[model samples]
Target: MWVDRADWNCCGEPFRIGSQVTWELRRDIDVRWLMEALGSDTAVSVDAFQYHHGDTDVASEQTSGTVARIRAVHWRSAPQTGTVPGSGVLTELNEADRGAPDRGDLTFEGFLVTLKQ
Candidate 1:
């Protein structure tokens, strides 16, 4: 679902929900911020500033073959009510949250990109 600005004009269909996407990193962003956005049910928007190299605008420099962008989408999940609404049956939760298997070893690689406005 990653569309460069140059290709955006050619796209006919609108972006839909639940579509996972990845794009370049236009500006510096914190990984925590991205994680928070993903966890939330609302859409978060941020502005992207055009970079400059010497007297030339880096964003318009497609000749260098380097353009930065970010990947993100608005996600919605069923509300967490702790149990089924009608039925009285309880739902099982993730084992990781219960400290079953210690898979806490997590690492994030690559730069955290943000969606450009």
Candidate 2:
């Protein structure tokens, strides 16, 4: 689920594929709350960023590197109307995320994240 509430704030245009970066949560609340309210099902995108692809009982987008099973999430809300998680699971796992080749600290400007895919 992608956060899209009128009260909620979004950073900027979505990045492209192969762009490695880190992003922080905009709100303090869990996205599951919004997901349950909007989405009927959920699943994480295989991409490291977890780009939303809508609800599905079976995994969608079988293309290699495009389908990662995000444990047990079943989002039913539409991307244009769902809530995005505030956590940074994707960047945390990939130790070689943005930042430097050694340190993994990320820099942020408002909500913009810079990284290397």
Candidate 3:
């Protein structure tokens, strides 16, 4: 799942910014759907960045980009278990430079992306 500040058209109705959109990772390289959601038709770059130690401890660094800031929201399956699954979120974007958001009880790893015409 991903929450973005853009409209998405991959799953029938368009999901606007802040809407959680779910997408399956295919072979870990299929990102066409995500690019489309960001309203891009050309090439885009996606890079992975780590910003947290676990579900409780957090440490983030500042980053800038031309497209989107992809952050991973990680959480545990149960209260007694450790951190497990993760989802992505689209944060500050389009030439904006910012640091990772505060993840109080969840882990956030992120990516800095750029779009090309």
Candidate 4:
């Protein structure tokens, strides 16, 4: 999960930089593959960005026209079972940047946190 400093009400919590915000993967893309494809300092298309209310399990709210920045990429697994079910990455974005021109194209800034399950 992640939080937007400007859209605290949307998240239903106080604004905190780098906070976790709920995200939904629209496609079945490998996190490692996506990280490699994006590389470092490369802009990525925000078309894949889908946001939702943090308090709900069902994806009923969708935030459109936003940008994303890849923060980190790592693999996660259950140490006890040695089962690697999924991986996650963090991304950051500005609430004001939403609906801006070219918002649907690519983004070079903001924060992000992504999880693949």
Q: What TM-score, over all chains together, does every model reach?
A: 0.19, 0.23, 0.26, 0.22
Candidate 3 TM-score to native: 0.26
Tens digits of per-residue lDDT for model 4, 47-92: 2433333435443344332223324223333457432333333343
Tens-digit lDDT track of model 1 for 21-105: 3322233322333344333221133322223233333333222222233332222222574222222111122111111121223
Cα error of candidate 2 at position 76, Å: 13
Worst 10 residues of 1 by lDDT: 89-98
Q: Compute the lDDT for candidate 3.
A: 0.32
Ranking by TM-score: 3, 2, 4, 1
lDDT of each: 0.26, 0.27, 0.32, 0.34
Off by over 4 Å in 3: 1-83, 86-88, 92-98
Return model 2's CA RMSD, one decimal.
15.5
- The number of clashing residue pairs in each candidate reads 1, 16, 0, 14
Report the Cα lDDT for candidate 1.
0.26
What is the clash count of model 2? Answer: 16
**Number of colliding residue pairs in model 3:** 0
Q: Which candidate gets the maximum lDDT versus the true structure?
A: 4
Collision pairs in model 1? 24-69
Mark the regions of model 4 whose C-alpha exceeds 4 Å error after superposition. 1-4, 8-41, 50-110
- Worst lDDT window (10 residues) for model 2? 66-75
State the local distance difference test value for candidate 4.
Answer: 0.34
Model 2 global lDDT (CA atoms, 0 to 1): 0.27
